[model samples]
Target: MFKADLPGLKEEVTVEIQEDDRVLQISGERNFEEENNDTWHRVERSSGRFTRRFRLLENAKMDEVKASMENGILTVTVPKVE
Candidate 1:
């Protein structure tokens, strides 16, 4: 699962989860309030701190990885048991 929302910031979020292929990543950033009478506003969001890694399979079950974020939307739940 993947979610993104960073336009003016208000609970930024980022989540990723995969089972069979082993992949669990999480990201979060929220801090907005600096735009008004400055003549400068051009950013596609995505700043600082961002990591992602995944390459696994074979009964992957990293402690039932799970994540959650409100407002901005960020939910990652991986559960693959066989």
Candidate 2:
């Protein structure tokens, strides 16, 4: 389950697959949006870059991997090589 509090992060996210080494890399960054009004409040959300790397198996099809995000949920599909 790929869920992030970052709004409008679809364009900044990236998914890369290295077929030679069978390594998959997923990365993205979430920035803080400045609010017009500043009031005394508590901020628990943190802004930074996030990355994930996964090693694929020999039967995995790197070219057929698909990713989609909806309602802050990201789903990745990996097809096996036939």
Model 1 clashing-pair count: 0
Candidate 2's C-alpha runs over 4 A off are 1-8
lDDT of 1 by residue, 51-73 (tens): 55655456656677666656655
lDDT of 2 at 38: 65
- Against the hidden reference, what TM-scores do the models get? 0.32, 0.78
What are the lDDT scores of the predictions, listed in order?
Answer: 0.56, 0.75
Winner by lDDT: 2
Residue 41, model 1, lDDT: 70
As for candidate 2, its clashing pairs are none
* Cα TM-score of candidate 1: 0.32
